[model samples]
Target: MSFLLNEIAPDDPMWNKRGALYAPSGEGPTVWAADDIYTVKAASAQTKGNIGFIEATVPAGGGPVPHAHTDEYETFYVL
Candidate 1:
C-alpha cells in the first residue's frame, strides 16, 4: 500500500467561487456527473493499493447516495 497527501486550492475553478463561498456546479451535475451536491475539499482515496488524499466541501443537504463498497469498507465522521 502507499500513502500521500494532496491539496486543492479553494479558489480552484472546478468549484465556482461566488463572493466568499463556492457555489455548486452551475453547469449542472452532467459536468462532473456527481450525484450529490458538494465541492471536493479533501478526500482519502485508494486505487490498486495506491493511497492519496484530497480536500473539498459539501453543501448543506448534499451528500453521497446510499451505497456500499464491495471491495473495501467505508466510514464517515461528522464534523
Candidate 2:
C-alpha cells in the first residue's frame, strides 16, 4: 500500500533523547521533491550526524542524479 506524505507521523519521540528509534511501517517525516517521495525514519540529529535512514519512493525512470558521499557510506535496499 502507498501512503501520502501527510498521512505519516512527522516525528518520533524516541529520536529526541538519543534513545532507540522505532517507527512502524508508513510512519516518518516525509517530503516530496524532484518527482520522488522521501520519508526519513532516522534523522542526522537523532543519530548525532552519524547516520540517517530514509525511505525513498521513485517512479519509473525516476531517481537521483549520480552523486557521491564524501564523508559517509550510502546503501540502497530495493523492496
Candidate 3:
C-alpha cells in the first residue's frame, strides 16, 4: 500500500518546552550546506539519545556518501 502526501508526518513532543515546533537555525552544528545543498533537521537531540532523524529534501542524485557505523543501525523511510 501507499500513502498520500499528508499521510506521512513525524512530530516530536519534545520539540519545545511547551509542545512548540522545533526551529532550525542557520548557524549551528545541525545545519549543513554545500554544493547547492542545505539542510537543518534533527538527528539525535530530538530523540533523547534513542534515535536520530531528519526530514530532509534530498536533490536528485544528491545524497550523502557511504560511511561505516559499528555502533548504530540506519533505516531509510522515503515517504
Candidate 4:
C-alpha cells in the first residue's frame, strides 16, 4: 500500500544533534538531507515488506555516491 507524506512521522530520535536539516546514521553520522527518503522494514514496522524511498535532491551536476546492494534488488520509476 502507498502512504502519504503527512502520514509518516519524523523519526525524531534519528535527527541530528547539530539541529541541522539532516540526520546522521549510527556508524558514521554522515549528513543527510532532511527530505531524504527512508524505508521501514515490514518485520519491524509491521508492513508487507521493507519499504524504500528517497527524500533528497541532487545539486546541479551532482549525483548519488556509488553504492550497491548484495542481497536485494531495487527498481526505480520516475513520476
Candidate 5:
C-alpha cells in the first residue's frame, strides 16, 4: 500500500487535525452507467488527497469491470 503524500507542503503542520460528522443521509454525484448505483461520498479534494471514498450498489449477478487505485490507501466496508 503506497500512501504517498507527494503534494504535502513542508511548511504545513502535520499536527493540524480536522474532522467531520455526518449521518450518511445524503446523495452525491451519481451516474447511470453499467447498471449500478454509485454514490461518491468523499472525494480526493475533500480529503486533501488523504483519502477518497464512495458507495456503490451493484445488482446481484452484475458488477463493474476490474479497476485499480493508484498511490494511496483504501478501506472498503459493507453494511
Candidate 6:
C-alpha cells in the first residue's frame, strides 16, 4: 500500500487559525440531477477555497462521466 504524508512547519500560522467544522447529518445544500443527489456539506467559500466538500448519492449506474479537473484535484470516498 502507498501512503501520502503532509507536514506543516511548527511555526506555521495555519495551525493557529485551525478550527472545528461540523455539519450535522442531513444538513447542507442539496442538488438533484436526474436520479442523483449532490450535497454541498462545506462549500469552497466556507473553506476559503482550500476545499470543496461534497457528499453525493447516486443510484446504481449513475455518476459523472470520465472527466478531469484541470485546476485542482478531486478525491472521492465510497461509503
Tens-digit lDDT string for candidate 5 (9-68) = 323333123445131546555555578776665556556667666677878876667677
TM-score of each: 0.33, 0.71, 0.47, 0.32, 0.58, 0.72
TM-score of 6: 0.72
The prediction achieving the highest lDDT against the true structure is 2
Pairs in steric clash, model 5: none
Better of 2 and 5 by TM-score: 2
**Model 3: lDDT of residue 32:** 37
The Cα local distance difference test for each model comes to: 0.39, 0.69, 0.46, 0.37, 0.54, 0.63
Report the C-alpha lDDT of model 4 over 21-76, residue by residue, as the tens digit.
23233221223443343332222122223544343334555544567877776566
For residues 21-64, what per-residue lDDT tens digits would candidate 1 score against the true structure? 34344331221224433323323321223432222245686655
Whichever of 1 and 3 has more TM-score, that candidate is: 3
| lDDT by residue for model 2 (1-79), tens | 1234333222545444345667558977888878998888876655666877889999999988888878678898998
What TM-score should be assigned to candidate 2? 0.71
| Candidate 4, lDDT over the whole model | 0.37
Q: What is the lDDT of residue 64 in candidate 2?
A: 82
Runs of candidate 2 with Cα error greater than 4 angstroms are 1-18
In the predicted model 2, the residue pairs found to clash are none
Task: Please give the lDDT score for candidate 3.
Answer: 0.46
lDDT of 1 at 37: 31
lDDT of 5 at 37: 71
By summed lDDT, which 10 consecutive residues of candidate 5 come out lowest?
1-10
Global Cα RMSD, each model: 10.5, 6.3, 11.0, 12.3, 8.1, 10.6
